[model samples]
Target: MLSVHTSPLHQPGTGDAGGMNVYMVQLSRALAELGVEVDLFTRCRGEARPRWADLGPGIRLRHLEAGPRAPLPKEDMPALVVPFSLALLKEERRYDLVHSHYWLSGQAGRIAAVGWRVPLVHTAHTLARVKNAALADGDTPEPPSRIRGEHQVVGSADRLIANSGDEARALRELYGADAGRTEIVRPGVDLRTFVPGRGRAAARAALGLPVDAFVPLYAGRIQPLKGPDVMVRAVAELLREAPELRRRTIVPVVGGNSGAGPRGDAWELARELGVSDVLRHFPPVPPAELARWYRAADVLMVPSRSESFGLVALEAQACGTPVLASAVGGLPTAVRDGLTGMLVHGNDPVEYARWLRWFAEHPQAGAVMGRAAVGHARSMSWQTAAARTLDVYRDVLCAERSGPGMNEAGATARSCLADASLLEGREGRNSTLAALLS
Candidate 1:
């Protein structure tokens, strides 16, 4: 697996790290549980680290020196793809199939796969065209060069993996991807860790939230794309439009800054709206701790302008917390409207504020939705996701073997899947390095 830009080992909710990091981490670990040897290659930045680090029983993260020995802005990643690919070629024929997460990795993976004569499996994670169309306020547009790169990847990859049916359709509609080559593989939640039934009162108290406060939590990277500003504005809108709701309402934003997500942007917006006292922000927390925040909230808010799979919503649901998300991208798939939560249309703060008010005004209804949310979450397990992904790997592998002129990479993929006995294992994990790097 190629994650050329960011390593799965990096902490999420920070610059250039979010769901994709979590997705890669969790998915790889699950694949490892299924007995698949996952050799994940990524860029080396920061302090000098080992070339390879054991992620799990069957997973290893290999750091390859590319650009600099420190993290660089994602905008500057394209120039390093070839260098990364060249570095990877030194390990020619070391593995079977090459799977890439995100476009940068796809570019690098494509070059290596062709050189090694192996098939390439690519997951866009989030497409440039898709993001550019739904860019948040003050967010920079995705460069045309990225669109060209993605177009090349879409055309060259043996298989395109989409986190949702919506994404699969976009691949066809946006990049003209072949439907036959597309795979719809949904992301999963950690049921054991994100389980429900925690005492909301104690959770709130532990998290420094008001014991009786109607908390609406927005957890994820605090960026324009994630719409942290929109969330702040909505809470303020809710309070200003209905001052009585302010009596016990509080909006807690959980996450770190990313891109132009200035550390104080959201806070300043809150202050300007004269709602700073009611709107709170915090650094990102580990999953175990985040579950408490999810359990304590009346509704988990996802105001993203666009999303590929909205993993945060699923995590919140797993904790018996209903989500109030923007009806964009895979958020509709994540939050089952009326059952798990409501999906407000457009980026209108007023629309989100309306749903927030409804949840605050009807606590019993929210609780009932939360119960249903748990059931929904439990159904989408990492075990199931892993098994499904293995099927894709196997199908691609076996198919390649059956065809003429197979390359070393194809042989590798086929050989890896040939372990019929290992296919029986259940699972999945994702993240830059944590989940994939697990």
Candidate 2:
């Protein structure tokens, strides 16, 4: 697996580390559980760490030296792709396929796959075109070079994995990805780690949150694209609509500064809106700790302007908390609208604030929704995702073995896939989820 831009070792919700980091780590571990030996390759950032380390029984993380020993911006990463690819090629071991996460890794995977004569499977995570189309106010657009690079990766990849049907359609419409090559492999949450272990009251007491407080949590990188400001604005607007609920409301913003540069201004926006007292900020926490925060909250706020998939939403739901997310990207699929959570149509603070008021006004309804969310989350898991991903890998390898004509290769791949009865059985429950949504 090629993950050139960010390391799985890094703590998520900080810098460039977000859902993609979680996706790689969880998926690799699940694949390993299925008896697949996995090697995760990333560009080395710190000099103190070893060259490679065993993540688990069958998973290994190898750090390849490419650029400076310190962290470099994503823009500088393109230059290091060739160096990274060269270092990756120096590996003595052989592999069946090269699976790359993100376009930066896709560039390196493109090189490594050719060098090893293997099929290249790429996951975009987030497309430049999709993000650029939904840029937040005063947010920088994705660079032209990135758009061009995505186009190249789309053309060269043997298979493309999308987090949702929305993402698959985006690939086909925006980047001209071949419909036959593109596959929907939903991302999954860690079911074991993120569960409603002791229910909401216990979680609230543990997290030091008031038992009766109306807590709407925002957990992700503090970036413009994530619409953290929109969350703050909604909080302010919510207070305006229901001033009596102010004493019982607490909004926890859990994450660190991230994006192109320093973008941690959610509190400043709150201060400007005169609702600083209602908001509490914290640095990013691990998955286990994050799950506690999710359990403590009444609802998770995923107000991202452009999210390929809202993994945080699923995590919150798994912890028995409903989500109040923007109806964009894969969030509609992640959140069940009125069933599990409410999906606001746009990034408008008024709509988000209205939902916040609804939760504050009808606390019992939120609890009922939270119960339904747990059941919704249980239907999707990392094990299910890994099983489906294994199917994709098998399909790709079979096609590669067939050689030349796609007509013969497609038939061969499908015929072989039919033999995997166990995987096919799970396929019935998740026609919408090719495996499970991340």
Local distance difference test scores for all models: 0.82, 0.86
Q: Which ten residues in a row have the lowest lDDT in candidate 1?
A: 429-438
TM-score of candidate 1 on Cα atoms, chains taken together: 0.90
Every model: Cα RMSD to truth: 7.7, 9.0
Query: TM-scores, in order shown?
Result: 0.90, 0.92
Cα deviation at 340, candidate 1, in Å, is 0.6
lDDT of 1 by residue, 1-438 (tens): 999878887777877888888888788989988888898889888656776788888888888878788878888888787668667866734667889999889887766665565688899999988999987667789999999889977877778899999899999999999887889998999887897755688788888878878899989887778888889889888998889978898877788888533574777888899888887768888889989999999999999998999999999999999999989888999899999999988889999999898998899999999999999999888888889888888877776768753343334443543443433322210111111111
Clashes of 2: 3
- For model 2, the local distance difference test gives 0.86
For candidate 2, the 10 contiguous residues with the lowest summed lDDT are 429-438
280: Cα error in model 2, Å: 0.3
- The lDDT, on a scale of 0 to 1, for candidate 1 is 0.82
TM-score leader: 2
